[model samples]
Target: MADGAVSINMSAEECAIQALADRVMSQIADLFFAQHITPTPVQQQMLVSHVRAMALRSRTGEPLPEVEEALFEDISPDSMTLAQQVVDLFGNLPVEEAWLLSVHFEVAKNEG
Candidate 1:
């Protein structure tokens, strides 16, 4: 550590996790453009952070927040579909991850 400075080191495992999050976000950004959804900078950041946290949860087997019982049943179909596609890109994430992302997409659209 330098004088008057604090240093934080990320492990190789952590680096890999962050890389996965970045890749997922990059692809999702392309998908958003293709789907004609313009994500604001705030939306992009929010979504990226959400994916990173979710990835950590899945990789660590941490309990994720439960989605509603209805889950995708009640959300906008387009957002749900978009979320499913994005989640698919993340590998074997729980379907609840998709539903959570669908809510994020739906909210981001309205807010953007």
Candidate 2:
């Protein structure tokens, strides 16, 4: 786990989920670095938290609350593409997952 990562009680399965989330976040950090998108510490923390939840959802087949597509109309195509790529890492997530995740990337890019 990265420095400052959340500490939680975990069963064996939850530990695996945390490991998966850590791997995915490492890839995402590399992607952000390659793109010169530096999220602030707070933003990075939020992203990590969100990805942890995403990892659990991926493992459990949980669905996201419905997100309105129009809310993301202002998101850049690049952000959407990147978000979709992240969502694809989980293999079975819905498009709405991408849509929801894109907000984090979009915010980080804009605020970077």
Candidate 3:
């Protein structure tokens, strides 16, 4: 027998949760783009940089520290309240959707 570890695939429920997380992150990105608050190139770059970082971190086993940090940084005079509203509006989605939303929040936290 080989010494390598065996790999086990995720269940259907796990897959759904992963997909949902992606959707939530995409939704947050869409919301930010729609608001047009990112007026400068630097700002856009910042957002994208954060998103990428978050995505990479997700692949690893990092906790939600990045998420919290991003939220705190991004919650400014113009967009903070809107972000809060968006969170409230979509907070109580179903389990799958909620998972997606959590993913988005994680991404957003990293991005901000």
Best by TM-score: 2
Question: RMSD for each model, in Å, please?
Answer: 2.0, 5.1, 9.2
Q: Would you estimate the TM-scores of all the predictions?
A: 0.84, 0.89, 0.38
State the TM-score for model 1.
Answer: 0.84
Assess each prediction's global lDDT (C-alpha) against the native. Answer: 0.80, 0.91, 0.46
What ordering of candidates by lDDT runs from best to worst? 2, 1, 3
Task: Look at candidate 3 and tell me the lDDT of residue 112.
Answer: 44
> Distance from true position, residue 88, model 2, in Å?
0.6
Q: Over the stretch 5-87, how does candidate 1's per-residue lDDT look in tens digits?
A: 87678998788789888888888878878877777788877888899987686567777766674856767988988988987
Candidate 3 collision pairs? 20-100, 21-100, 25-104, 70-109
lDDT of 2 by residue, 5-100 (tens): 897777998898999899999999988998899999999999999899999999998888878899899999999999999999989888888888
Give per-residue CA lDDT, model 3, range 1-112, as digits (tens).
2878787788875565556556645766577677643334554555445444444334443444323345354334344454444445434422222232343344444454
- Cα error, residue 37 of model 1, in Å, equals 1.4
lDDT of 3 at 28: 60
Write down the RMSD of candidate 1 (Cα, Å): 2.0
- List candidate 1 stretches off by more than 4 Å: 71-74
